[model samples]
Target: MNNVRSKICGITRVEDALAAARAGADAIGLVFYAKSPRAVNVQQARAIVQALPPFVTTVGLFVDASRCEVGEILDALPLDLLQFHGDETPAQCEGHGRPWIKALRVRPGDDLEAACQEYVGARALLLDAYVAGVPGGTGQSFDWSLIPARLSKPVVLAGGLSPDNVAEAIAQVKPWAVDVSGGVEQAKGIKDAQKIDAFLRAVRGA
Candidate 1:
């Protein structure tokens, strides 16, 4: 089987970031949105990034934050990628001098292809479950059938992904990558090493 990349999101500590890397995660996401329970400050994010081993990508996740706020975090850390989890315009996502992925919360009757076209500059489109007033990390699964078989850009499957269900999700979606946050967590922001290992194993086995 071909390799499907994995990303462990909502990492708050250096220990968890290192754990994700050890568990063979391709990337570790640091939540920068203040509303999220897993959100991290600049110091915490920097510490996690510094502790990660070689070849593990560091991603900074933001909500609908201002350009200045995003710039401040970018200036402080050596993040490999930026993940915008809110309603950000294409222009805002671009001109940042770093690659970015835009997250779209999937809802019934939504035209994903058209939305993808609007955000044509994104490196990939991350599909998550849509909850009223909730940004992301909802730990809820949406209808996988809503995704089109072909997309102009790559897809990163997320939302309610755990060791038990990830294999099935991979078979169904066949996304370029899979991102998990609450799925491998001991609690809101704390990562469970055992869960992380099991999740990776499931993905690789699939």
Candidate 2:
């Protein structure tokens, strides 16, 4: 089986971040959007980032945030990657001096190839479920069949992923990586250790 990387997103505490790293997650996401229940302040994010051991990627997630806000967070945190989860223009995603990925909420009749082409400079594209007025962390699955068999860039599958269904998701999507937030959470912003472990095991088993 191909190694499918796992990212534990919506990290708010140092302990949770450490737990994820200890569980062998490839990356941990820190939510920067204030509206998100998992959102963290600069101090929280900084502490979590500092607590992490070497080689574990730290990703900062934002939703339609201004350049100034993003810059401020970048100055405070040593995020390894940026994940834009809003309707950000391709040009807006560039020139940040950091590799970034654009998240697209998949819906029926959506032309994914064209969308990927628009964000050609992205390091990868993350696919998530679309809910009215909800940005992400919806914990709702989309139609996996909506994804194309081929793409110009790598794909990171997200949305409604848990240990139970992650193996099936991997089999179908064959994404480069899988991102999960609410799936392993005991509540909003609180991660469950057993769930995290099971999620990793499922990815490996797949």
Candidate 3:
């Protein structure tokens, strides 16, 4: 079986980004959402990107941001992927000339198959926990049984995953990738090297 990939989201500092990379994270996420405690500006993003080693995908995350705003960030640095963590339609997510993924908060009564069909153009689908009015970064997990056995696109499981439970999550969900933000953090935007290492180790062991 192919080892599940990992993405360390909401990376702020160059050190944290390096820590994740050294720990064998396939990707690191940089939040562009202003309201997020982990949000990073063009300068911060650039610095983090520049300090990283080769072959590490840099993902730019946004939450209901304007097209212009996203464009400006893309214009500033090289974000290998875009993560739309808000209510962006397929049409709106398109035209960026870059590969993108849609984050859907899993709530009861939601049709995930329809969402997969809706964002058919996405490279993958990210499933997160649903918190009323909160887009993501909720340390609380949702029902894993909610995910279907099959979908049109690859699934990148998120929501409250940590070192202790990631093995079980990967074994159960069997997602294409796993995303973590607050799980490995020492603070809101600061990552603990030990936690990051342990998280990656757990994913590998899983």
For every model shown, what is its TM-score relative to the native structure? 0.99, 0.99, 0.98
Query: How would you encode candidate 1's per-residue C-alpha lDDT over 1-206 as one tens digit per residue?
Result: 65999999999989999889999999999999988999999999988888888999999999999999999999999999999999899998988889999999999898988978999999999999999999999999999999999998999999999999999999999999999999999899999999999999999999
Candidate 3 colliding pairs, count: 0
**Model 2 global lDDT (CA atoms, 0 to 1):** 0.94
Residue 18 of model 1, lDDT score: 87
Q: How would you encode candidate 2's per-residue C-alpha lDDT over 81-168 as one tens digit per residue?
A: 9999999999888878799999999999999999888999999999999998999999999999999999888999999999999999
Spell out the clash pairs found in candidate 2.
none
Q: After superposition on all CA atoms, what RMSD does each candidate show versus the true structure?
A: 0.7, 0.7, 0.8
Candidate 1 segments exceeding 4 Å error: none
- The per-candidate count of clashes, in order, stands at 0, 0, 0
What is candidate 2's CA lDDT for residue 80?
Answer: 91
